[model samples]
Target: MALPKEYVNQMRELLGEEAEDFLASYAEPKKTAIRLNGLKIESTGFGEKEAVDKPSAGQSFVAGRDPVPWAAGAYYTDKTERPGKHPYYYAGLYYIQEPSAMLPAELLDPQPGQRVLDLCAAPGGKSTQLAAKLRGTGLLVTNDLATERTKALAKNIERAGIGCAVVTNESPAKLAAAFGATFDRVLVDAPCSGEGMFRKDEDMVRQWDADAPARYAAMQDEIMLEAAKMVAPGGRLAYSTCTFSPVENEGTIARFLAAHPDFEIVATESPAAWGFAPGRPEWLTPEEAAALGPDRTARLADTIRLWPHRVRGEGHFAALLERAAPSGMAVSGASPESEPAGAAAAESRKAGGKTGGASFKDPKPGKRTTAVRRGAEAAGRGRSKGFDDRTGGESDTIARYEAFLRESLPGWKPPGTIRIKGDHVYAVSEPAGSMQGLRLVREGWLLGLSTRHRFEPSQALAMGLKPHQAALSLQLAGESEDAIRYLKGETLQPEPAKVTGLNGEPADKRGWTLVCLDGCPLGWGRWDGATLKNELLPGWRQV
Candidate 1:
């Protein structure tokens, strides 16, 4: 683990006596950590004495451990145990991530009901955190350049229990055209030369060189430009990288600021004040470094950097930028462009415009009308019936019916018996049972609708539940261990129990119900006939 001559000199100039000691300690990159998803399970309650005291409850590693208050629920432990085998991991109650990498999302401070974009999201670590911060409200668009990686990113987002998000595999240009100036916040967790990741992945060191930083800095510039276009006026953006090059850190930001005069760098407090040490300094121009003053000489004193040698975590960098109000420009609404040609047509047809009779189909007859009626009743209650037509014109009538169906049932598959009206598509589940207990799939979580059609939480949404309750929790006499296990954030059989309790009613008769433990919400479940089915909650399933 040899430090670059320039990096050593910069550190010596900055830290003096501490420089050599700090640089010598990085014998190797530190191992990664896994943090439980608090949205799925109450992480704060996990290690509490009262929680562990329960006769039926099992012990959680995070429980009773004194975590770094600033890094809530974060801890460093030996990786001797296989984390993937843990029940909580299987349930998507946590995610394996680099400890230092968590800083950017915390700094960005995402809130519910605010639209956000992750410009270079992939494998979705920070993006999922942003989703959790959003609390499933508003919209999150996560984009990645590599198509294959985007699929994995989407899966991670789904596992994290995110709803109201759009995942795209596209370049910055395409995203800019599709959704310019619409996000309240944008995250540019840009791709970079893996300097900071050297400790975690030694191969990165072998490939590292003086030119790598400059090369990545170029790409970072372009990515930041596209990111700027997507940020709404007064919105905030966080730029981060897992590299230790000033060219990729402050230099990149400086270039961006120079190009986009409407944006300004906002200073942030030290992680030290929050119980962590100040991070490494990427090389900076003498003037820029001087501006930080005598107390702090790290080139990025205004930004945050986490060095494993100093902070007991991986190395990373983050800077917060806020877009100033547009000058001499009228603020106007921005709508995302429609989907690609064929997909758009299909979507429109699904929305209920008659494309052709070929598009309409009635479900098999005599299957059962009760479930059909239930779905219809739920849909009717949620929407107006003014779109219905009296005349039963197949194409015209079904078109209108389909449109209504699309709105009422976002994921419903229209039955063949439905007819098309002028601009609407109408459909009834011929064998209504087929539509019974349809689960809402967003991200990857199965959304349980309350009797009032509101979403509630349940544990069935996590991926780590046991194949059978026996592997997860202590079974209460006469109750299905599987159901109890799912709520406990343990592994369980795919079959979940259908229970009723929106306002805490007796668990019976079911369409879907949110499962909870000790009154805390977990995720949602769907009941089909006599069986309760698991709809893994998004975000919570990414264990």
Candidate 2:
């Protein structure tokens, strides 16, 4: 690949003597990688084990190697291995991601209990990183424009074991309406022309042109505006892109600052205190350019601008902006009021479970109801029994179902606390706690929990004293050795097992048992009073 004259000139201005060499190297962007989920495995520990474990999922790790520097717990791969298919990938131990792509989340520094947003999240690389940063608390709203891509993003979030995120498919305007000035931090890792990715994805270069950055900048500006509105006053917003064009980098920031005086360009220091350079005044608007003299510009020097030639990662730009307090706007860290009635009801249905067709009784009138058939349909004609007899038939079925529900579950409402989307419902309770407990519904699965605690796990508090609790330690009749290994976290072939209580006795026990390694709960397993079944731990199951 040949460098454009503009790029060559820019490189010369940026790197002087090494510009030519940098251009030559740019023809093939080096592969930079990061471990999947750092919260599960530290980079240093993972790298040390990678040599013997060959962590690239059987992708060779070059026998003797050091860690990649751009991101912690990251390494460079020679494109000789398929890291994506490795067992660790399945376990969510680490995510294979580009080195530079990891920067925005790092810069945003999302912490526990902070409400954050990933405006253009899709296929969720950055959003997953942000989720890990949350450490499983607070809300993370990850939105994307494409429906198909949003599904992929949601799956990655699930595989990563992220619990408090709400993924939405909507435009920036819709999101702003639903959640205005709500987030503690907002990230606009907006869509942009693929300049930095060109080296890795050659097709990008074929489609690139000078005008692409300008076009993308226009979209980015709108996204940044929406981002500003959603960010709480005194909160922060980090805008970034993978392209090197000034039009999409400093130029975009400059334009935004010009339009929104309430946001200030906050300087950020490096993690190691190496420091950063300020945005170039030449790229700023005339007014902004004059607001800072050479000396004041020097004071604003910690804004980041990472170049491929200068940094060990891909070409990327990021700037952190702090929202200034708007007059009379409360900055008390309150969340926005509940969503509108009909939208709330729609969201409730999407959350999964049976909606009673009655709207909420709140004075706000934020919920609406719609009715569909209530019970299982007739079999052969592929139609429900109520189809031929809508009025009396369906009504009778619903009444009977409601009566049965009332008798069996006195205080329980239908498992309506979950919002089902596609194959899964974001439940306020674990599906297992519901009356149907583990039964599959059209919504895929039903999860139950205490209404007060939402769906947070209580560690099977009841199991702590169950008569068969000890049965969790039972061994398979023919595979005692294998059972021991399984308890020790070793990989074992599937086999049948006989279940017995801790005292070596058996009863009519049929339910899930919690397996522990030296008293530390490993995960849950099922017992049919005879055979034991395993449900992989959220983080320990891959092996």
Per-candidate TM-score against the hidden true structure: 0.62, 0.63
Q: Write the per-residue lDDT of candidate 1 for residues 21-103, one digit (tens) a residue.
A: 66765775475666545344332233233332452232345534333333334544565756655544443556777877877
- Model 1 CA deviation exceeding 4 Å by range: 1-17, 28-31, 42-59, 66-69, 273-282, 286-300, 326-543
Model 2, which residues run further than 4 Å from truth? 3-18, 42-65, 68-72, 271-278, 285-301, 326-425, 428-543
* Cα lDDT over the full model 1: 0.52
Model 2 weakest 10-residue run by lDDT: 375-384
TM-score of 1: 0.62
Cα lDDT listed for each candidate? 0.52, 0.51
Candidate 2 lDDT, tens digit per residue, 418-533? 34322222233221112222111122112212222122111222111122333444333211454455544454333334344455454345544544321223334555654455
